[model samples]
Target: MSIQTSRRALLAAAALAAPAIWGRDAVAQIRRGDELTVGIWGGAQERITRQFCATPLERQHGVKINYVLGGTPERRARAYAERGRPSFDLLYLNIFESRQAVKDGVTMASSANVPNFANLYDIAKIGGYAVAFNPVTIVYDRRKVAAPMTSWRDFWRDDLKGKVIWPTYPGAQGTSALLMAAKVWGGSESNIDPAFTNIARLRPFAAIQGSQDQLYGMFDQDVGAASVEFGSFTRKYAETRNPNIVIADPTEGQAIATNVACITTGTRNQALAEAFVNLHLSPECQAAYAEEIYYSPTIKNVSFAPELAAKLILGEAAVNKLVDFNWDLVIANQPRWSSRFTREIAG
Candidate 1:
């Protein structure tokens, strides 16, 4: 069956099974007087927390959740500098930063107590780290082009010169865009020079800096024909009367980005924090959050809403085709890469 079909089947099964799934475990773990603090990015992250995490966690566990909002890199640095006296107990960070944070000792090793750690998809539990969310496929404005655009190579087409708006240098997604360029030009984990050369070739077309909101605005105003942006952000944009916009999974393979959750070393509430992670990975929680926020579900058994399922790039087969990277290398090499990128492209 197609991914869409399987997703629908899964969602149907989850909806039918949710009440039974939450029956005893949730109540046993959470108490009425207990509270937990979670750190996440503002805007959409906050929205997801309110709509998905907070309400359900409160209802199921009788646990009150307090949210602290900031960019992951900044918040994580502060947490580590404070040396276990972090204001928030749980943190939500993008994959590369999450890996870096763990390496830096900002995050603690995950506890087995988180109920569904074993139930997570293999990729979600990289080593002992748990991915909290998945970004959707890249998107474009269909009205700006006629032919079907299929891969990252399409962005560099000579005919579409000076028409692409890209994220700023050093940004993870921006860097991913560069990696996509490398992949298209035959660069792999062992080689990246050709990709850098290819990017330099497209320097004339690049928009070096812009906020997500600004990128969306450029698309709406026809300032740019396309951009590589998160699926959820594009979907939200499409909902705001930009019916001409559409998402396309590149023929080569879809790229998937993750946000992760980990344990902290000095937590006084280790058990509670672990429980929260467990709840986050539960099928009920995954389905609820996926349906509400339009992100792909990470828990294997949880199902995405039909619309979201259709939009997600990392379906079963697609997941296998995803390119894996050494995030530590990427983080370490970021400065050098950014410098070269600025000198050649942004300068």
Candidate 2:
């Protein structure tokens, strides 16, 4: 049978068996015509997710999807504030926010809810079920820098001083940059002193940017030469806005925080939530998402088209070059790190 047919059969069997294995209540919780609210970022990410996953699933199953779109900070804050009565059943969060969700007791355990969770990489199967990623590395105006950057340490290059942008601490890209600094500057998750010292030293040269919006006009306005940005965004920007923009894979590695989809504790339709998360991880959906949005899928086997192969993180060789951080460790020391970043790095 076809994949969709098999899925329908599985749903039919599961619904019939749930009453005996789980309870009548669990079966009733996600009956036909139910709507599953999913919290995620807005813009391209939202549109692509709908095209690749939400719309398809809604058609396959008798269900609806409601998108709760916002910034990562807003979604994270709301997930925490609502707690047991969250407005969303599914949340798409980055590695740090996913861990925070677990710590705050707002997400369901994937081991119990999502059967396909085992198919993801160990890193993807963390506090939340990682569905996608955007590998962040060096993005520069090729016209400005004669020689290509080959190391993460290139961020501190004196020749490129005052031309680089520093991400503020406590944000996704910011924390990833911190971990990058620590790794290349002789520090690790256990020791971040090197990262801080380097940040303080580079503060005078590197301008701090809170969001990508600030970096959009960097080249045209001459605010700076280049900035650390996600390869996905930079590639699209290069194609559409600035052909001068080019992404460099630091020999050290590009730091990426996996984006995950998790069922929240307050979900009234738990079964539908789990299935939606599972379907989002399917290779068909993942491939469509990767091609449409340029974010890497967490699946082990999906491949991109030839034209996209060089631009996106795909295949084993590229995947191995990814740098991951210890979110728990980052959060534990965030109080001190955030203060120092404000007083020293951005001061």
Candidate 3:
């Protein structure tokens, strides 16, 4: 092994007080009846997590998992407000929120804490250990959008005029969409002027939705042909509610981010928290998440069933077609971005 890998292995060995299982450290701190809380988005996500992740952890490690279910925004609010005393041990927060969590001294730093971190894709490690990919893309009602939408710029096509919607700012999908817009339209995170200018022009002809449900509702009514949302989210809504709705792989690529997992800084159960974090990156957990939820896995070379693999954003071909943004920039200038979207785009 290389020097770095040996050192990481030693670090993991020193931390675990018991034998390893499944090629991962199983520390004594994760004893029977000991509990670990995991915050996740409610509804379908929580369902899949319980069946695939929580049950197995409980069965194997004798650790009880208490899932704290809420909307992403609500859970993030709790994470920030609680900080040193977060209600959960492991929270599934967006990359931006996770990055902010680490900056605010809320995350346990280093791959040493979550040893499986070393097994993840490089992009997934950027803002803590990303557990799942959330590719923000152009979602449309296939029946209404006869031609495949080519790009975010397609929202402005003459045929789509007054028949398009824009995600409202201060929302993750919207913020990402606008940022993607800025970059593609000769503006950038540092210079969002052209983006706002063009957005203002499109405003009069576009509908604006503040939440995913509202966006889905607008699509149901044929109020718009396309809008921005995470690929997995689009799939979820399509399978359960709107069969005609589908994700459009834009020629310019989809804007990608992730739902990251981390052990909070002040956890009373640090070792168990770290263990659970490792399980999240485990091939088992990663595969379930990919297959069940359709969110891309972060671990390198995870094996998904053939049908499941078809639903995933896997392989180099799809990975190369994803657009990534600077989370630091997104987190830092959020206020200005929100204000611009409200004043210039939503007006």
Compare the candidates by TM-score and give the number of the best one: 2
The lDDT per prediction is 0.65, 0.73, 0.73
Off by over 4 Å in 3: 1-28, 110-115, 305-307
lDDT of 2: 0.73
Model 2 misses residue 144 by how many Å? 1.4
- Candidate 1 TM-score, C-alpha based: 0.83
TM-score of each: 0.83, 0.86, 0.85
Superposed Cα deviation of residue 79, candidate 2 (Å): 1.9
TM-score of 3: 0.85
| Global Cα lDDT for candidate 3 | 0.73
Please state the error at residue 278 of candidate 2 in Å: 2.1
Clashes of each: 1, 0, 0
- Candidate 3, pairs of clashing residues: none
| Clash count in backbone of candidate 3 | 0
Residue clash pairs of candidate 1: 108-263
